[model samples]
Target chain A: MNITSAPPTTDRRIDVALPGAAGQTEAVAWLEGAQAQIAGRAVWSEVRLEIGAGEFTAILGPNGSGKTTLLRVLLGELPLAAGRASVLGRDPGAAKGQIGYLPQRRHFDAGIRIRGVDLVRLGLDGARWGLPIRALGRDRVREAIELVCASEYATRPIGRLSGGEQQRLLIAQALVTDPRVLILDEPLDSLDLPNQTAVSALLARICKQQGVTVLLVAHDVNPLLSYLDRVVYFGAGRAAVGTPREVITAGTLSRLYGVRIEVLTTADGRLFVAGLPEAPAHHSGRHEHDEQ
Target chain B: MSSSALPLAGLSLDPVSDFQQLTAFPFMVNALEAGTAVAIMAGVVGWFMVLRRESFAGHTLSLMAFPGATGALLIGLPAAAGYFVFCGASALVIGLGSSGVRRHRGEESALTGVVQALGLACGFVFLSLYQGVLAGYENLLFGDFLGITRGQVLTLAIVAVLALCGFALVGRPLLFASVDETVARARGVPVRGLALAFLLVLGLAVAATAQITGVLLVFALLVAPAATAQQITCRIGASLVLSVILGVAITWAGLALAYFYSEPVGFYITTVAFTIYVIARVTRAVIDHSTLLRRRPEIAEAHA
Candidate 1:
């Protein structure tokens, strides 16, 4: 401890870094040529990937591509059988609360009858069972509602809400604790265009303003191009990680998916990649807004 | 209706004087007192029942006690104590056996189904064995509430205190866990322990009421008032308080009515509670519809 001198300012501001942020932990993930076991059997081998801090990397691959499995490893929900996976410069298990996880799909306990505000309150501290919840508290609940811009239906029971409304409520719940790293698995499900815009905008704000590190699992990159800092393409039993502009080349796209691929910018200037081995597009130039 | 006015009553089993039945006898007072006390615990536990979506568990618990009660009779032990032991043990077993919420099977529902079957099986077995040896025990099965004594009422008072203390201690975590077990577990709560504690409390309560109303009729005191309160209210604290009031009234009113009739006491208690539940349900629906209608004016003005 240091004894302070007499110099004083009228006001002082202190900055706090977010979780999985710059300088808090070395943002480097190192993996050797190790096999990933699935269902007690080794389906793939010799996988290696490195992810650095402050990187918004979208992991993309074909269906059944193990992208979701890879997210689980990063969240420590699954054990890496042959390879070691590290998160926030430590084992993933050590940082569960520190990391925010949004799964591809989750069923809300329909029996849990509560308003959107109370659901978000569960995120703040009620997620844990032992602690008491004063869901009626004024300011904190208000702040959470405002943070998510979920004030409109804050008092609306979740059972009466639409899919987009529920999605926002889920995101608000995820953000209630202000986690350091936000990892989302296909968060764009059932979202409308406006909601998608609102969510992406909010995520970008969280990343930039709060410095929260984000790892998004998405099939397409159009909605995410502006928000993502990098792309991690996984295929043929390996992963390649770098910037979207660097990773979205025709060669990289074809190599990642193993098919004839085309990357096109829409008339609205949205970056879209069209490639799939099966389920050929009816039109060569079909507008497949992946999440919109 | 005469007290041995007909001489054939001398050959009958344990005939009672007609005058002994008309007044507020000591045993009748004890029955009403014990019934009301146990009903308080029922209200509180039943709040959790509605919250946790385990009203079915309430029915299953009453049934589960049947085997334990009958088995106690076979072994020549106090059926109430046996119920406590069996139901408590069943609670712990259910806890250890159940693999938390996320499961391929609905373990609680499955366990309840099994318990119901076992209860019926044991009831039949005990009935065969007890054809003549357990004439009064049949009355105990549905409860001759007029037969309740001061000792049982005192026991009910003690249990009411313990149940209240348990409620105060775990009230918050209990609601949180009931609301969402998976999320609560992730939040570092001992979710399984909370679940077990709640189940044990539930067992203890059902056992207490079973003394006055029997395992067969405990549901009237255990579930009816609480469930009726649920229909009219959403706030848990208010619902709990209302349920207790409703429970006490049901039993007290049933006791008063039993004073005037020759019916089984459980029958009156259950009928009163069920009637209250139906009335509350209907009234609540009408009130809610009226409130929506009342809100239509504001909605129209806002649109304008």
Candidate 2:
């Protein structure tokens, strides 16, 4: 068989047909009464949220509050037990390259030998099944690397890079598709302060430059406060959707926590929620601290 | 003279004439041809097998050859047919069994162990039921290349080409899934299908390598070269090329040593392969230690 004769069979076109197209600005994501049950009990009930195109929104919640489950529902990996969800005016999974996703932080094994650029290239056509004839999307891969400021170490093995550098490459991987919506899960979990700020700024730049809607999940919100246009904060089977100032206020958060929570803004404009429960027992001594 | 008493250790000192003598026989030529085909296929598949940390699955697939040969003897069919059928069937079994917990961790190994145990037990049962003496048993366990036929060499060549092509077709996506399954699945990559496809390709590679190296010694061809190459370099393309080169070099050396010293080829192959891997590991450790030492000045400057 001629290995390079055929284009990759996995290069199928996404079904992007919208249901209605009259004077409607297609939302990047929409969910109303989205419910997820665990052990026959709904962790998320009647959750309603709409993410406008090009909006940068943060999904915040304590553990077991279905923040990840919400992202999964948006990715169409999990079906809503109740209510409806749509992404780009179609089912979330209908389009292949419309949503760029950055999964939670995962460190590669030292033995994994893939380079930073190769990881970005995989996002280009990693699912396709054939030998690439002629350097397919070579320029696009280079552009994605440059976009993330990872060109200096683009050829370095992914395992050798620091956590922040690796996360940047992963962002480049997600951006390679030029997706309409970007969904990141806990992208800033282990980053130092500077790297977290840099990644936050980079993501803001991405949203503005490409008009890509961004849904970022994080434990802490202080680093993201400057860039967040909106927030969808879920807690205890309920969700609140509004601007950062509206959703992160003491009254809204105290009601969500079922306990008094103080949302304090320091003089430098960093917000930190105090008097929430302590870190969970399992997470007592870990490097990762729980969100308030 | 006992073959064990032959001067194998001394042959290395005067290797040029020994090498020429190894090429003197027609059987040696056929053996080399088969080894070359087997080496290339094993090298490519083994790189993925190691990368995916599916070496246990690979080992189990190689062992499927045992029952395959015994079953073939019972059914009056060629042993090669048994090897492919058994390996392919086991691949499906392992794939389906591991599907439940692709992300669960530790579950796949338990299932693989069960399948491997079942396969080995079946092999023994088949050997016991055979009415006639199971001749060539030693040859099946510790391979002999002295009687390799031209037809066998051609079969090896075809299987190698097919396996390599299949690997090439899925290599990019396979690496993507293998490295990061969660992100790949999120990006619309078929993570589960890729896993199953990789297992099937691995089965084919195991079947081909089993013919030349025997079931027990298959890892000498499949794991050692790839593992050694990985220890030496952290580049995908370079590691792959290095693995193929290492595989071929060791196979040729093993065949020549087995020919000159009159030993089982598996012994020479496994020994040499293990030695190379150990050398690579030592070299990596040394380089890492020195790099840490070299960075001490930078740490001191930062402190200042």
lDDT of candidate 1 at residue A126, scale 0 to 100: 59
Model number 2 iRMSD: 1.6
Predicted model with the maximum lDDT = 2
**DockQ of each candidate's interface versus the true one?**
0.19, 0.49
Q: lDDT score, residue A203, model 1?
A: 75
The positional error of residue B256 in candidate 1, measured at the CA in angstroms, is 3.9
Candidate 1 residues lying further than 4 Å off, grouped into runs, are A1-36, A42-59, A82-84, A108-112, A127-138, A191-194, A219-225, A262-265, A269-292, B1-25, B102-108, B260-262, B279-304
**TM-scores, all models, native as reference:** 0.77, 0.86
Report the number of the highest-DockQ candidate. Answer: 2
Q: Write the per-residue lDDT of candidate 1 for residues A1-292, one digit (tens) a residue.
A: 1112212311211111122233325653334454565665443345555555555668776555557777767777677777556777788667787876666655555434456776677667654333354644557667756876779777755654666677777777777777788888887756777777777777777777777787888776767767777666665555555566656666676765556787666565466667644332321112122101
Candidate 1, clashing residue pairs? A19-A180, A128-B187
Instruction: For candidate 1, give the lDDT of residue A27.
Output: 58
Candidate 2 chain A weakest lDDT stretch, 10 residues? A9-18
The TM-score of predicted model 2 comes to 0.86
The first chain of model 2 has a TM-score of 0.85
